[model samples]
Target: MGRLYQVTVVGFKGERVTVDLCNTEEQMSSMTVEQLKTKVVAKLKINTELSRISLIFADERLDDDSKLLKDYGVQHMSVVQLVLQVDGGRQL
Candidate 1:
């Protein structure tokens, strides 16, 4: 079994959830950002597509879906911000 870490995911509307994640250095290093996004989507019950969302941590935006979380310095008890990408060119 891998080590478990506590994580808090906060949504744009201030909705937040605390979840326990089992992540190992090896596992996370091998996982890509897209995979992480999928995991977050499942945990947060997000209704939007993966392309319409982004994860932010420590005031930094996570953009590379091909990189590992460790590369982004994501650690235990980290708080990740979930933001919905909006197309400004589109009329509401």
Candidate 2:
């Protein structure tokens, strides 16, 4: 079975859209945040560039110096939050 992931995209309007990674593999393990952003862009067929969005990785590890990743190892069914904030004049 392929690894599954829950990606939540939060908009500026306080609306969230969750997409499921059903047929995805464990490729995220070997990819950086930038690489993963590219994948997400391609997967979602986003017209804008992937770098235009803010990608947040919340894993299962928390450090005193960093609050980015939590202490919950990301697994097959991990749920991640992606906040997509557009500029004031930027429109889809």
| Cα lDDT of model 2 by residue, 33-69, tens digit | 4544555566556667654655544632112222212
Note each model's CA RMSD in angstroms. 2.9, 6.7
lDDT of 1 at 17: 84
In model 2, pairs of residues that clash are 60-70, 60-71, 60-72, 60-73, 61-70, 61-71
**Winning model by lDDT:** 1
lDDT of each model, Cα atoms only? Answer: 0.76, 0.47
Worst 10 residues of 2 by lDDT: 61-70
Instruction: Give the local distance difference test score of model 1.
Output: 0.76
Error in Å for residue 85 of model 2: 2.4
Alpha carbon lDDT at 14, candidate 1: 87
